[model samples]
Target chain A: MSDDGFLRVADVSKWYGDEQVLHDVSFEMDRGDVTVLIGPSGSGKSTMLRCVNRLAEAQEGSILLDGEEVLSPDLDVNDLRREVGMVFQGFNLFAHLTAVGNVALGPRRVLGLSEAAARERAEAQLERVGLGDQFDSYPAELSGGQQQRVGIARALAMEPKLLLFDEPTSALDPELIGEVLEVMHGLVDEGMTMLVVTHEMSFAREVADEIVFLDDGRVVERGPPDQLFERPERERTGRFLERIASHD
Target chain B: MAGATRPATVRERVADSDRSVGRLLLVAAGALFWGWLVVSWVNRWLGGVLVPVGDPLVPPGAVEATLAAIPGIAAYAADAAFVVELSPEIARGTWLTVVITAASLVVGFFIAVPLAVTRVYGRFSAWVSLAYTELLRGTPLLAQLFVLHYGLNLGSYVPDTLSGVFARNVVWVAIVGFTLNGAAYQAEYIRGAIESVEEGQITAGRAIGLSKLETIYYVVLPQGLRYAIPSWTNEFVYLIKYSSLAAFITVPELYYRADQIASETFRYTLIFIVTGVTYLALVLTASKLMERVESRVSIPGLGVDRER
Candidate 1:
């Protein structure tokens, strides 16, 4: 509930018809900090990420992004989306555009950058993700790993203050997962502020500033990865960790 | 077991022979039709030698003597002579048909895009688009043309200067009718195409900060239109053939011209055959052209069979 945090979500509740999806979920991240939300399926992890960008509206909540009330009805959703970029689990690159075209679209159209300038910016982002040679390749022509990198590049092209990753590696193959994670690791090294919902416990343990364990649409526990993984305070958190560890 | 199989095998053979005979007849009929078309097409150009006004390709009498020496071909050449006489008129009519079809299709495209967007994304106005598509699609185009030309007297509303160069108002009325009809069908094609695009694309578009309309325009329509090319090509062919309906209102397109020539010369069989062949040629050529366009605009790895 502190207004001093870089990005804050407090008392956020959402409903799809009569069923409640998120129940008073609250979290905060400092600038350049990585917060990972991990939970079982149907635990409102993805919905919580979506609410930050207003992709899914929260019926009851106050989401403040850099002290600006994002939940305000008068706020322009497009403007909010520009500052808060999201990388989907499904690398939803435009099918008709090339890898560079996919990255350039936001800059060219939304940011009003010239075609040459946008393309130059897109190439720079793509190169950052190790896709400099694939500027002309379409999404269908790229591997799942490469496409996810392009997706990351697309989000980075907008130069957003906060980035949301909704299970970004979930849709990738086991071998391809490393490449996307590597790009994310690079982003982390450069100090990008990120809120990620993921099942990659290793990733969370390594890179996360804080790991928030969510269960049944609420924050069950929040601490550093070592503290949460090694010395858990909550019984549900220990059970969830054991269950996920069993899968791996 | 052999005795029982014998009768069944005989019956099967009889059926197979029957099918073969039918196929043979079909092939013969096809050959005759193509032969007649080739003869008429050749005579339409070559029959000019019958005239003695200019320096003949060969001496006029010499060409005639050679044609006569060919026996059955001479008879075909004689029979096909009218095709030469009618060629200029048919050519003009074909040009008009092409113009009308192309204009209507282009104009209909502009109208259909908005109409399709409304049907897919318009919260309250979706039903309005649905009603328009159903009304146009449910009714016969001929009926619509009649209502426009006769009931509404749309032709009279057009000034003489515009219609004078064309066939006095009926042509414009036909264009209007065909455009309205085409837009409805085209919109449906586009609507289906738009829907076929994955929902994630719109979410992705919005996530990248595009407005709903921008997403539809940039993310949705490009892929949708690519998906629509096959169906849109179908609509194009349909428009070409349905344009014949304009002749009902006396728009002097190919069919109308042929009908006029048929009644005037009392050569219904011959004139109608020529007209039918002309339409066949037009449709086939149009299909080939559209196929080229489809390939030209098609994105690699995005066609139906290419889906991952």
Candidate 2:
């Protein structure tokens, strides 16, 4: 495969102890692409997303982001993580900080933005996420959807090149999921490059530029959402889709 | 009668009466103890004025003559005289105890923060921290003070000029011993609190591009230290009490002064009880102050209750 793709994850594999969780996972995404990873439980979808930022080590693979190797041992992981922001399923906002404080921390600490400047930037991002009214709310004070929005604003405040969503909406109540998804849809429309691990099939169907079906740590199928959903080429992909559709 | 709630039987009524009587006795005993303490404290300060000097309203020795005429009051007056005479020395010693505890705790906190962070995060240094904590905690604090004072003979190393300033270096050595000992326990409290913080907070810190150490400092310690307030309050109370051990090295803290007065007056029971009460007052005051600190720094909806 050509290495010219904006983010190329080639033959990435991982192990936790003796158990291999990912097996030679390979994929590519363009500069403004929305690639969604959908899989059944224990399929290593989250691990694959984590490897891009080196949050989880890919023991045998090269992840090249915009021509720089992400898996290089000497690479400054902090620098890579700064460029590759992540939104957690659990919406792990700093519980000690207010919404504005949470978003301002990275810019203030990492980017060395002045307190006033960081606050300004944080407020702007919070406003962008439609949480202007919640600048002072703590993680515990906010609803699940509101907290996740703060989490997104935190990531966006970093001005990252790529955003990783690890089951971003999975932990939300069904009614709360839409607000988070709406913010994500806004990001997608604005052409933010996002790699998402989610079970939101409707989200995968609508916003995903390409949906990669993964199972047992391997990519079973990958293509545009319409082709993959309408006529899955693989028997396993069909079965998985049926299982997910039945649940919905 | 069948539909009504059960009436108390004779035996049950007796048991209830016994409980109420027990409670009443407890309240009376508490009141009497506190009242005695208050009376003794007042006498310790004012007993010396029994013969008021140059006062036109009352004649000199008039109060003493009146007290002696009473059957039981003469002995009480003598006890009051002893307390008043010893109060000045004991007050100085109590001041020294406060200074030692405060200095040691402040210095210990600075050392414990780094020790705790290294123990929880550092690969090789964790073992060093573990060994340090075990060595300090395994021995009694009195023995540690002895080791510094007698075994180490730290006074010899002190310059002659500095020796006179610090009670022949005995006070400084005791402070050093307490600081080292307090740091070990404080480190463990901080480490336990750090570990209690959710693992996800660390991930969030790192995800925001912070290095591991930065994440631990910025994210983990803030939350951990808040969680540690209750334990740290216990530590403060322990330090105030254990500071009595410094008297073993003849640092002339509260216990040492009490021992001296007890030996001189042969009033062991009176002197020692007063000393114990003073220590109790110190510990309770420190605990209350630290409780205020805990509540002040606590974040709303975090581990600590906002109402607290």
Candidate 3:
């Protein structure tokens, strides 16, 4: 990766209570590219992506988002979250809002867009995710795929610099995963910067500019998709690749 | 028992035990019904002995006086029949009642939300919540009113110029007394609602990096308070009935005013009937309005009507 890459994580470590979950993790994801972090459950792959937005703080080391230190003494957490949008595995759409209203909320309240502008932007984002006709639907009314698409549209409505997807498809039925992935893949095609924590190995191999494999609490491999997966040059990553491929 | 030649038929044993339990329930219900019958009989006998049933307690040897007074009572009846005469008094009384009700609601609400929060998430002890709920639900509203009105001398705190006017007024006393009492019960209603709000939603909100307070106000409350509304409406209706306790301390509320008008006119049944209708009217109106508001703010595009 070039020095001008957007987000650079170096030697990032995280802990919960006395249990250390991520250790000495290092990676650089370029501007306008998808970097998929894949590993077995509890591999701390999601933790690294969450660390960028400080949803989970890194106990030690540096995380520079857009070349500015996002994990430091003076990190503005609220500003970071607003800049880096996240879509949860459960699709945490506000149950109090419609799809349009949920998409409109951040841009309207946080960004101070006019009602007309916010609704207009929310519709456009919803339309981008193939939810044009379902703008008025609530999350409770929609399938998992539609809800995740709305989740993406909600993140996009913020016009955030980076998007984080932590097991976005894991909560959906296998049939529903494709709808969510299609929206994400479209974002990749449109040159959006994203860090995805996924078990969808085929999608990772297909769409990721880089694949970073993690285990226990450390990065096992990091490189372009071909270099990391095909020629990992590590026994750990080779096993991980085999495990993910077994899912197919 | 072990030496019994053969175990009693299992079905027979089960049937015998089931019969005993059913007989016990039957006996309990019969006892309750008899107890209610006895209490009612005694009360009816007592009222008959003291007040003399079937005899209107008019002033003695007052047939001539009654004949003379017919004109005045008739004129009053005419006013009631015309109905407009009672409107001003009802309207003023309605304003006072509404002001008291609304102020107490707001006060109770402010106290209840925090109290509910403590009850739901308290680290100290279950007693913190248990004591609150038990104490409020346990105490009589009459005692609560007297404590506020005289025992506490809430009247003494007021300026003399206002005391004579305000102390006699039921609205001020009812507002203060009713709110404190209702706040305690509302504490439970709100706590239950807050608890019923999905725990996962709270965890999800926290994962988004929302502070605990932000999560409550933004995520938890927006949903929790929705669940709380119907219960809150129940409490508000309870307040309307509870407001009648204001009469004992002399609020000149519907029942109190009816008592006065009845004493002056000797038409207790008619006046009480009117009071009942008005309270019923207030409760029904409140119910309709809250139902409408609940629907409007509900999760859009979802017809799932969450009930209390």
Candidate 4:
């Protein structure tokens, strides 16, 4: 609560059975900041993002979103989720629902809008993600890129206070990644508060206000993207960046 | 080449039509042969007795008299009496049968959906549902009917008003037995269908902030129900046939009335043949109705269209 940032994670630790996944992870994000999390495959970056929204619970420590403690038992997780949108790596759009139906579900069901109004809002959101032409297409009919765009549109339709992206383009084809990233870049330009976990280093370098490097469930280094990318203070962070750069 | 191709196409069309006509003639010949054989068989047996056509222990004019009496026997067998005299009672029985099946199915559905959800999602509920399903599914439906109708003595424990309902109507017992038996089978179908849905959909529903109940209702049930259709069709057809068991309890469904009619007239074959045809018609109608529903609800990429 002392942190003035819009999102504050303090000393969070998580375990799955006996294996610890996150160890005392802490970070803060100001409003409208696009903070990108970068790490090796098992570095708990995805786990951390999930914990922030309580999609994955953190057994110890507190997460505060807009000065409210999300880790408390009494909190209404659904209400909290209404304010925090998430796009998954798999583009898990409902297979039975068309693009517009997917987007409109949250509005009509959770937000309690009428069918026509919810569909109108859904159409606008889909258009924002450049999927205006695909409103009636089911997820199975859409390609990976179009499916991911619809996923983004579904999240965007909620008009959440913050958005989380968990490797949104990882499951897309190489040629299809750009379209989804382009929609996300547009969101950053629109000044959406976003916490993103991705290995798309170029997207990170271009759009991230701050880059948070995680290793072995700990935040290794964090700074403005240029500073973290160009000049790293920690040897672990430097090696990791060098390895990632070499891959490209 | 154009002149040659035009003649070849015309020849091919003629050949195709001629083959079809030949096949039609073959089928008609086969049908006629079977029809004649059936008529001669009937004539040898019943016709000989009635007409004395062959032996002359038969009189010469008996054939004409027998021919004259044929319409009267036909009339007595299937005529206005069965339709007009017995129809009201048959109709009453049929209405009760419809009530039994429809009410049992509706009540069973309500019982099953929740139980299936519990079995899938809740630890304690799974055990209870497993035991209940196993118990009901393991025993015979006829045995269950007997237990409900005769074994339970269900009226004495009830209040006066409902006790009368139980005493006056054995249909209530039939409905209860059917509902209990059907709910178990339905719960398994539902459980299987729910399990068939991808895990990712559940994750997606949760990620999008749908409550667990809402997720099951809006996302899971629609898909599950579609998947359940093949099994549900079997259940529905089974229900229509099984409703005949109510006759044993004196609930007076179609089979019960048919049985009474046969005994009264001493015409077991006639009554039973008609009753069997009625049951077949009911089954055919149910299957056709289910086929329509299946086509309507089937998803483009799922269910029967998966191969396409």
Chain A: TM-score in each model = 0.98, 0.98, 0.97, 0.97
lDDT of 1 by residue, A1-248 (tens): 13359988899999999999989988888889999999999999999999899999999989989999999999999999998889999999999999989999999999999999999999999999999899999888999999999999999999999999999999999999999999999999998999999999999999998899998888899998999999999999999999999998
Candidate 2 structure quality by residue, lDDT tens digits, B1-308:
48888889999999999999996885676565445444443444475353332121233255456666789788676555556556566666776788899999999999999899889988899999999999999999889988889899886787777677755578888889999999999999999989888899999999989999889888999999999888988888999989989888888888998998788879899999889978887786687688789889878778844225
For every prediction, compared with the true complex, DockQ reads 0.65, 0.69, 0.24, 0.53
Each model's lDDT: 0.88, 0.88, 0.77, 0.82
Query: What stretches of model 1 exceed 4 Å from their correct place?
Result: A1-4, B1-67, B159-161, B305-308
Q: Which is the winner by TM-score between candidate 1 and candidate 2?
A: 1
- Candidate 4, after superposition: displacement of residue B155 in Å? 6.0
> Could you give the candidate ranking by DockQ, starting with the highest?
2, 1, 4, 3
Compared with the true structure, model 4 gives a TM-score of 0.81
* lDDT tens digits, residue span A61-165, model 3: 999888789887787676677788888888888787789987887777667789999999999999999999998887898999999999899888888889999
Mind giving the per-residue lDDT tens digits that candidate 2 earns over A1-248?
Answer: 13349999999999999999999999999988999999998999999999999889999988999999999999999999999999999999998999999999999999999999999999999999999999998888999999999999999999999999999999999999999999999999999999999999999999998899889999999999999999999999999999999999
For model 1, residues B209-233, the per-residue Cα lDDT tens digits are 9999999999999999988987888
Stretch of 10 with least lDDT, candidate 3 chain A? A73-82
- Taking all chains together, each candidate's TM-score versus the true structure is 0.88, 0.86, 0.73, 0.81
Candidate 2 off by > 4 Å: A1-4, B1-77, B159-165, B304-308
What residue pairs are clashing in model 2?
none
**Clash pairs (backbone) in predicted model 1:** none
What is the clash count for each candidate, in the order shown?
A: 0, 0, 1, 0
